[model samples]
Target: MTPVPEPLPRRVTVHLVTGGPAGPRLFGARVLFGQDPADVARRLGGLSEEAPLIALDVITEIASTPGRVPTPLHVDRVVFATPEAVDAWPAVLPPHGMEPMLAELVAEEPAPAVDRPRLRRMASYGIVTDPTGRIMLSLIADGFPGAGTWHLPGGGVDPGEDVRSALRREVWEETGQQGVVGRLITVSSHHRVPLTGHEVYAVWVFSHVHVAHPGPARVLEENGSTADCAWFTPDQLGGVRLSATTRRGLEHLVGPA
Candidate 1:
């Protein structure tokens, strides 16, 4: 059997049109590796300056074409939201301008791994709610940071995988439950030095999720990062220790629970 090559990282060039007579518009064009917004726009039959560049949403997929794209007349994703409501969208918004980031994204050379061993990871976690209003959490297995502590059911997004898909996969693997992915609630980033001997930066995307009917919580993956899983009521949460990301997500999404 032939070995499969790794899927290249994808770029979503997002332009936020906050002001104009036509009102607000959010335009996103999905571009492949080494493709810029101008190239994508030209291929789509539109102008690259349709709106102001605001964010670059990166996604990895298992497989994709070289440069297949959305039509110019109809973009891949479009939305209209007030500035305050932008966070509700599924796209990740950066804190600063996207120009510098965009430049680095299309760089030809990969960052060296031998120096200090730096890694950046993206993950999707959910604040899952059952019909009974209970929240689900999973215990981190031993040898991991915050072992014995509980956190939301999620892990790192795999290479070539989108965040939403990763969330569902991880949720099922860690908790053995099915969830309907809802709106994005928050995005957070944390940098840790010397974490398992690497300087790691993690970007966490949290969303509200609903589990219409749930079975007994259990870890379903063999030797996975999760040791156990369970649901908890808000009142029962005070005594349980939570990972920093989980605590922050819960506080932002549903208040200190």
Candidate 2:
């Protein structure tokens, strides 16, 4: 039997961001040195000769921080890429040894800076019900901006509120009909809007047994978010316009039955 070869240590180049919000920001490339340090340096040095200075900075950062550095000591906006040539790294690197050289290299060259916006988020759901209490489908209003087509009678989950409560509130507000939540159906996501997007998780639910009122459905509030809520049978959906996500939600709620 042949002896199994030891797995070559994987190499990764990581970008480190250092500096305070008010002070100058520095970007450094760090090469994750594996078994050998000297070989790592040689490979990085060769790459730096051909690649841009920014690439060199990233390599230097990785070489400086080996098994011990905590992630937060670095600032935000670090980029990491797996090295394609793992075998080229040196087999022997000194422990706790490369920081001084890395510091000097980073001092000589600094990285460019930019501001990134914080992501804003909100959660909603699709509530559906079927006829004869078997399947459920939520009513969706058409022509809402960015919604494009189909939508469920659900909206933003409030702070500290559970998903069930949010779904009930959204259903009542959109459909003006009370319903009891049944069981969780499915969860889905939609990213039609560029910066602001919606993540919807749906639950199959039955109509509240107590509430009994019905009339011609029309836009009750017209708050610019929705046009009107109208229930549809699975067969009725054929001609009516619906969003792909909403359509998918309907399928989950009522599949073949």
Candidate 3:
């Protein structure tokens, strides 16, 4: 069977008109075309033939107010793009004179909902802290059969298990460190492995606790889900290779400074 092609990224643009007695007028427009130069030329040719040419005089008249001689009106260049690209266009064009005003007009649209059906699974992770509020992390055993990235100690909440209870149990089972799970920090949604399957709902808790003692952290069972754990400072957090969802969860707890 032939492999399917991935969707192409879209390009978009906005046009702005300034001058005349009244002030300025802004127009939002878009053109859908592929990235190839030939494709772009073809689309441009089609547009030139289909759309009537915009007259400078008409643009000036529209910009001018009653009894006021219209100042030299400037019609900015035309731009093109798909709907998504158009929505994300920058407020201002070139010439650097109209950036502030034009940028205000550029707006971001919300992402469309995911279409795939996924099982709703909840997992809780505790940002467990020591006496000085340093975060705890762990490394999985070499024999463990899972993604071998260093991660916070936690696990999936079984059926009938409360989120906090699950966190405590998982932490103790994985790291042998006992601590109380505290307030809820944030919840994030992420697609499961292979990106073509179900989604995982992860809840992160900012728990306040003191570590009783430091012990060797290891993966007792050879589970194929998690492999290692270790403590990470905020600076070290960035260097650790974590799943996208896990990174998002941690970022939620430690917001932009």
Candidate 4:
């Protein structure tokens, strides 16, 4: 049996040439290196032989991976084009009329930045009821920005960690309650960019829990992210300051409590 040959890898040359008074402008040419690397290099915007250029290695789209953000520069103007659109290599690139092309490409077809703002979050909370049928909740002392806001007895889900496991740990640490997390109560999320200036793309998950408790909720750890913890009845939930998550938790587990 004959073995199939792998598809040829696309190699590319990028040109960084001075655009008149503007700083450096980038352009690219790509083809299978085995077919015509030198030709592709020559066609990259027909950059002048004297113009300074930066050589880079660009693999085929299949081989491309997520990368770091490119530094933005203050340029007089930038002229750039994708290699795919240039079907036939021209003998000479037009020197004039770059402004219109630059406007169309840069403004209309803005390149997706590698470090664009992306939302990411994950949390787990357990629901525990006291002998009076009151729900266990935690008060944020220092961590959650809202000092006295009520929150579910749970916290963030660490990577490579099970959802139930994270909930169990958070419940113990924040409320001094021991429990086995039960079926999921609800899954909800809200989007907001943190001021910390980090970009992370993620999905959020929530679950309901059954606690094997000896008594009411109390802060297990001293001076933890949670300031204080307690069990509150449904009638009292409305009067107390509550986080959105806490409100949602109440709405899902029991109606409007």
Angstrom error of the Cα, residue 92, model 1: value is: 16
Best by lDDT: 1
Q: Looking at candidate 4, what is the lDDT of residue 127? A: 74
- Inter-residue clash pairs, candidate 4: none
Off by over 4 Å in 3: 1-117, 139-146, 191-212, 222-224
Order of candidates by TM-score, top first?
Answer: 1, 4, 3, 2
Query: Per-residue lDDT tens digits of candidate 1, residues 55-136?
Result: 2233332322223552111112212233443464444344553222333334344545556765656678989899999999
Q: Which stretches of candidate 1 lie over 4 Å from their true place?
A: 1-7, 10-17, 20-22, 25-104, 108-114
**Across residues 1-257, which tens digit of lDDT does each residue of candidate 3 receive?**
99995422212222333223453333433312212221232354343324322211110011221234422211222333332223333442335433223233233323337665434334567677766556776554455423555566666655445556777877777766778665445433333444776543322333333465655655454553455556666776767666544555567567631
CA lDDT, candidate 3, residue 210: 48
TM-scores of all candidate predictions against the true structure:
0.67, 0.41, 0.44, 0.50
Which should have the higher lDDT, number 2 or number 4? 4
Q: In candidate 2, which residue ranges exceed 4 Å CA deviation? A: 1-122, 130-144, 191-219, 255-257
Query: How big is the RMSD of model 1?
Result: 9.0
RMSD of 3: 19.8
* Model 2 residue 46 lDDT score: 40
Judged by lDDT against the true structure, how good is candidate 4?
0.51
lDDT of each: 0.63, 0.39, 0.45, 0.51
